[model samples]
Target: MRYLWYLLPWQFSPAVLTVCVLTVALYLRGLLMLKRNGAPVGFWRPFVFFLGLAVSYAVLQTYFDFLAQHSFWVHCLQQLILHHLGPALIVLSGPVLVLREGLPRAGRTGAPRVLREMRLDWLRKPLRLAWRTLQHPLIAPLLFVGLIFFWLIPRVHFATMIDTRRYLLMNWSMFADGLLFWWVILAPKEEQGSAAVGYKVRLLILPFISMTQIVIGAYISLVPWQLYPIYALCGRALAISPMLDQQIGGLLTWIPGAMMSLVGVIVVLRHMMREEEAQLRMSPLRAETPGSSRPSAEVA
Candidate 1:
């Protein structure tokens, strides 16, 4: 029983539980359906999808969340997983088609109908406009970097640290923004069509994100006084001094954030290379037959 406590949620949230459960159920059911239809539901993608979901859930729901509340470094790690690692993995898994397939036929058909019948169809145009605005190439990256800085503001951080609703909102915003930003960066332009941001543009945006994180993390680490004293009052789960806690948290934010951007650059390079290879393959080959009059140097 004592050991069982380790698995229980530090603070239960019905909403989080529902979202996680539904996500898993939908994915698994869709995966099964895809397998039946021979839709090439590969092992790695499902494994990665589940791994991302598991890590995200672990950070938010398990006893680890209790430590996160009382330790700055823990919180930083939690946010890293929630806002970066988890979302990146999930996006890489290419779960969109599977999740769509997982939906009930009634739901797939009736959702838009229900919205129109409810007279909320009027909202679609404005909602799409808002999405387009937020998803603008420039705005998306800026918002992604801005959220990291915003939640770290001392006063704002303090408020979120103590207030459950605000805290949840902060976490959710990071996660949702992460999904949006990574999708823009990683999805093939072919899929996104006109909305797609080019790999070259994403390369530029990633560095911008890294520099801002470095600036803030350096500030937090170098400050003589504690930037986040809330952990001290919360009965720090770790035995480290406040300064050490702050520094560790700062390092976590600084190092991992920058590394994530670097990794993004590498992924972008791979995408560019893949496209180049495809183009080369498709380009007409000039094979010279023995009867063809081609210079030896040119043929070589």
Candidate 2:
């Protein structure tokens, strides 16, 4: 019973619960529909997606949130889930594909018609245009890196921790931006239209952002002074000294955060390799190995 109590929300939000439940129900429905059609709806993707969603929710609603508020390192760990690991896992699961089909037929087909009838059709183009602009390769990398620095500013970080509204807003922005950034980095180019960024561009962006994290992290970890004094004010959950807490937080920001970038690069490279293999398989003439004496052969 004590263990079960820890699973409950520390400060329950009906809106968060509704969104999470709705998505789970919709995803399950979509899975059933796909299975009925003999589409290959595998086990792992849905599992990963749910796990990702659960992690984000856990940090916010579980006893973890209480610990996070009182400890700088725990807070950084919470941010990592909300901003990196959770969103990356969610995107990798292909939720967009399932969620689209999960919608009712009327909702899918009649949405445009209803919008037109309501004289809100003009909103569609502008929304799409805005999305494209935001997802632009250059802009995306900037925003992804910039947001981290923005929130890390000692003053801003202090205010965000103390104020409930700002705290909620900060969490929301982190999750949303994370989704957008990871989708750009990981989504297969073959399935994408204009949203597909070049592999080279994504590769470049990941390293740059990772380096930025390392720089900031090293500074924080090595600095003699306490960068964020809010934990001291609020009283730390852990018994460690303030410097130790700050150093641990800096290491978390340095290591796992940059690790996400490394993982993103590997995913991108795999996508590139798969696409190349596909092209080679489809083409009759193939490039011969440099060391092989045999000439290029026709593929079956």
Candidate 3:
């Protein structure tokens, strides 16, 4: 326990703190409105959201951040938490549904109404365009895969580590993209609608996306030379050598990261099966076609 304490330093990042606080506040406000309106708000939704925020804080503001700065494996662990697990939990919580439901109706006079008015359609054009692009079947999966490759380029990865702005950009982009990718996979059928990627397409694409992670991970793990020179040069915080650390990082990306996509695939498969069963149930029972012996078709 004492050793664990030493591993987790109490670091305060104002920016990260602010974001977490605001996210919690908004979620709480929405939850309260949902309850007041007699909406069926589940306890699990808020729990999942808070859990994600906690994971993000742990990665960004705690000793994890310190270790990540020195250890490639630790950094990979941080990235996985931030970009895969945390974002998946947050998306599952359905923050967009909560926020949309929480907002006041137009022409109403209240803080909620004022906030609603602040949406500013013109200001949202770029964001809307980006969202639409992300929702595209091909674009979302490709972007997810591309982002992994793009940042892994030694020069790009090292540059991000050295520059504060670039580091922040990298982290934010990872989190945002992760959220979007998972959202496409997990959002309800009605929510996905015709505009977004069809369920079957997403399921089909998932394996390919997962394979990319596996390939990247295998490459990093097997390569004899260190890809990121900074990690090699820096004094390692842990006893592991830089080369071993790189291998461990590669393994992390290869295994758990690929598993993340497999989990999505499983979810989609189950959903599709349920939909098929439902359709089977809902289909009208067909009358026996001119059969002399059969009276009527049994009800489904």
Candidate 1: tens digits of C-alpha lDDT, residues 232-278: 98799989999999999999889998899988888889887876565
Per-model root-mean-square deviation over C-alphas = 6.5, 4.6, 6.2
Q: How close is candidate 3 to the true structure, as a TM-score?
A: 0.83
Candidate 2 worst ten-residue window by lDDT: 291-300
Alpha carbon deviation, residue 176, candidate 3 (Å): 0.8
Candidate 1, pairs of clashing residues: none
Candidate 3 per-residue lDDT, tens place, 1-300, comes to: 876774453555577778777777766777888888899678888888889878877887767787887888998998888888999888777777676654455423543445447865454556557677888888988988898888888999989877878877777888888888888887656565444556688788889888999999999989999898786676777898888999999999999999998788877787667655654565524222233332211211
Pairs clashing within candidate 2: none
TM-score of each: 0.89, 0.91, 0.83
Writing each residue's lDDT as its tens digit, candidate 2 over 59-161 gives 9888998888889999889999999999999999988778867888765565467678678999878877878877899888788878888888999999999
State the TM-score for model 1: 0.89
lDDT of 2: 0.85
